[model samples]
Target: MGFSTTHLIIFLVIIIVIFGTKKLRNIGSDLGGAVKGFKDGMKDGTDRAADASAAPAQQVGTAGTAAKETIDVEAKTKV
Candidate 1:
């Protein structure tokens, strides 16, 4: 059977008695910090991906323009 509220309370009390409040508090804060770091890393990765996508578009645009100019020059020379 699943743990009832009374069972959960008793379990929590036993854990507190064993670890004490200070240790439990430290553990909770460490867990929170880990979660925060994970979120920040994900945001940084998403920003980098956005920047990388934008750079390629600009490079392709310039490359295309240069190719067009070269083709025009070749056509003029052929005349």
Candidate 2:
């Protein structure tokens, strides 16, 4: 089963005893930074989708040709 409230309380108590208050505070800040980074990434992805929707549609053949060129470049670089 997933962690219930009681389980979470017990886990927090153990973490406090093991890590102490100062280390726990640093961990909280680090976790906050990680969450902020994830939010920023999601925002960037959403902006890209919005920009794509606003732009004109490109020809399917044009995209296919560009993709082939990119693959050729990659293949050359690898070798």
Candidate 3:
């Protein structure tokens, strides 16, 4: 035996009778929101990995403002 269009039509009718049209629409919208949230979470995870890989080159107290602070302190100690 083979499935045909009539079988699908009857199944659809049964679904509509059981759930009504409004409930089906709400279910579709909720499924769409869940898919969107999953995609956004995947993107955030990739961005965090990239930031972590590039973190070691930028030292906090090894140059620029920190170096000036060390020099100033040494000069003050001699006065």
* Candidate 2, 1-79: lDDT as tens digits: 7999999999989989999999989989999999999999999999999989766566554787887667455546542
Please, what are the lDDT tens digits per residue for candidate 3 over residues 1-79?
Answer: 8879999899999999999999999999999999999999999999989988777656653567776666555547643
Q: Can you write out model 1's per-residue Cα lDDT over 1-79, one digit (the tens) per residue? A: 9999999999999999999999999999999999999999999999999999899888987997888667455547643
Q: What are the models' TM-scores? A: 0.70, 0.51, 0.68
Clashes by residue pair, model 1: none
Best by TM-score: 1
Cα RMSD, model 1: 6.7
Find the 10 residues in a row with the least total lDDT in model 1: 70-79
lDDT of each: 0.93, 0.86, 0.86
lDDT of 1 at 10: 100
Scored by lDDT, model 3 comes in at 0.86
